[model samples]
Target: MAQQERGNRSRRSILEAAARVFDERGYDAASTNEILASTGLTRGALYHHFPSKEAIASALVAAQSEALVVPDQPVKLQAVIDLTLEFARRLQHDPVLRASVRLAVEQTSFSRPAQTPYEQSNATILDLLRQAREQGEVLPGVDLQEATSTIVGAFTGLQVMSQVYSNRQDLPDRVCALWRFLLPGLATPGMLARLRTAPLPQTAPQAAPQTAP
Candidate 1:
């Protein structure tokens, strides 16, 4: 049992270190040596857990893709808001998520394409929007497919901008502003009135200071 726990810890450490390196240097430029150096682990230890650099990138993407938790709310629109706000919060604090976003965007540079994470995210948002439409939480006549695509695109753009401008220190405000601008057009009057867009509770570890590549 102790050995298994230690193995899990070692694997997690490698992933986190790889995430930081990837987030800084991007996939093609990021070196496996840097990842191992960051983890303070020998090559053998890293290879035991992950066969190659691509494996580490794949693992980070899969890990970040699974981190979102859909809140249970009577008004599914509110749940959607919660989901976006929470993700923004995580993006500010979580290295793995930051790396995942970078990988998803720059995946064309990689030998193997990374598509599942984006597809999963889109599917999750689309599912929630569909439910909101069915529950009448969305404004009348709103096209859910378009709305879903817009929301995902807008949210991704906002985070990228925030990261560039302020290292995501302003992400909470940007996300709040995003909702304030979007909710009126997206939500029913009562749903909009009831929705809360204040900063969500953050449970992730504090982000380390980012260094330029």
Candidate 2:
């Protein structure tokens, strides 16, 4: 048990260190040596765990995605709003996310061995949008593929900008404004009305059931 716990801690330390390096140097420029220096881990130790820099990046992406899951109870629009705001806030304040995002944005190509997290996160967000559509929450005429891409693009762009600017105070407001404008048109009437009102649910709401008609 102690060994397992120590292993987990070591892995997390490596990831956090990698995030710092990635944020500071970007993906193309970040080096395993830099990550090792940041974590104070030996080359052999790093290889024992992650095996490659790309693997560290993939772990970082997985950590980020896990952190973003919404609650499974009745969700108020305010909760969603708050959740998004918190996510943006983390992207701005969390060194790991900031670095990973910086790495993602700075990359010019989307080749494999480097595309795992990027592809996975995009797929996850698209799946969420598809669920919203099936739940009578998405507006009609919104093409699932296009809307998903747009939404992901907008959110990703926001994170990248926040990381780059580092001088903005209205990020939450900016993100909220963007979301309100874009989400309303895509929501069903019932969902739109609730979202506009920004009602606070007593508890976390269930994720809209995902089923196809």
> For this target, which candidate reaches the highest TM-score against the unseen true structure?
1
Question: 94-181, model 1: which lDDT tens digit per residue?
Answer: 7777887767666734545636566677888899999988888889888888888888888878887898899989988998898899
Model 1 ranges off by over 4 Å: 108-114, 201-213
RMSD in Å for all candidates: 4.2, 6.9
How does model 1 fare in lDDT?
A: 0.80
Report model 2's TM-score to 2 decimal places: 0.74
Q: Score every model by TM-score.
A: 0.86, 0.74
Q: Model 2 — which ten-residue stretch has the worst lDDT?
A: 204-213
Candidate 2 ranges beyond 4 A from true positions: 73-83, 108-118, 167-169, 196-213
Model 1, position 105, has a per-residue lDDT of: 61
Best by lDDT: 1
- Per-residue CA lDDT of model 2 for 1-213, tens digit only, reads 698777777787887788777766667788899889878777998998988987787666655565565534243333345556656655545555655565555552354453444565566566666666666666778887786577567877776565457643456666777777876667776776676423233233423221110
